[model samples]
Target: MDENSIAGAAREFGGKVQGAAGTVAGNDETRAEGKRDEVGGATETRVGQASDTVRDVAGEAGDLADRAIDTGRDVLPEAGAAPRRGGDTLTQYAKEFPLAFAAMAGALGYLLAVAIRRRR
Candidate 1:
């Protein structure tokens, strides 16, 4: 239990004791105060329980997000390996067609430069 829960329990026990003592002494005011304490203690205990429930829900959400990311990585490892395979294909094509590859590379560089300049 949290601090609020512990304090609430303590108050509840103390109230019971005070009420018993008040009853023995025939003190109406003391008995009334004891009853009020009992009600306050119950409210505090509910507050503590609510707080614990919220924390548990937030923790479960974080765990689910972590599991989703791990599953994505395991299911699509090829996404991470794609760049190496693409590079190998490009190298093979360039060896077979040097002049075509040079023209394509020059066009690609010009397009990249244009795009970068537009962004600024």
Candidate 2:
């Protein structure tokens, strides 16, 4: 987006110079060039505005996610009521279904391997 804006600005600047030169020289071609530059400048302004809007929206989304996480943590009960170790979570899940967990782990490992290979 920034690249697009920069290109548009450059185009507008060039047009201005051409238009000014054309006006002084009394050339129709020069006047056309100047008008073209003005159009390019307007395009750059629009693109820059759009880029800013996207950034602001993305920032708001991140803030919302953080607030949701904090609210969820506040809702959960304290460990003093019943302390469940890290392994307890895995044990309970595995007891429910051991094969499913193994397959999930295998799939994750395969995905990681593929990603690493692609990077290389």
Every model's Cα RMSD, please? 6.7, 9.0
- Which ranges of candidate 2 are over 4 A from the true structure? 77-120
lDDT of 1 by residue, 12-113 (tens): 778878887888889988888887888888788778888888888899999999998889889996787799999999999999999999999999999999
What digit string (tens of lDDT, one per residue) describes model 2 on residues 1-120? 566677777787888888888999999977996888779786886797788788889999999999987887788746433456666887888889989999988999999999999999
Candidate 1 lDDT at 104 equals 100
List runs of model 1 lying over 4 Å from the truth.
Answer: 78-120
The deviation in Å at residue 76 for candidate 1 is 2.8
Q: Lowest summed lDDT over 10 consecutive residues: which window, candidate 1? A: 1-10
Task: Locate the minimum summed-lDDT window of 10 residues in model 2.
Answer: 77-86
Whole-model Cα lDDT of every candidate shown, in order: 0.87, 0.82
Q: Would you list the clashing residue pairs of candidate 1?
A: none
TM-score each candidate.
0.60, 0.53
- Model 1 residue 94 CA deviation (Å) reads 23
Give the CA lDDT, 0 to 100, for residue 93 in model 1: 98
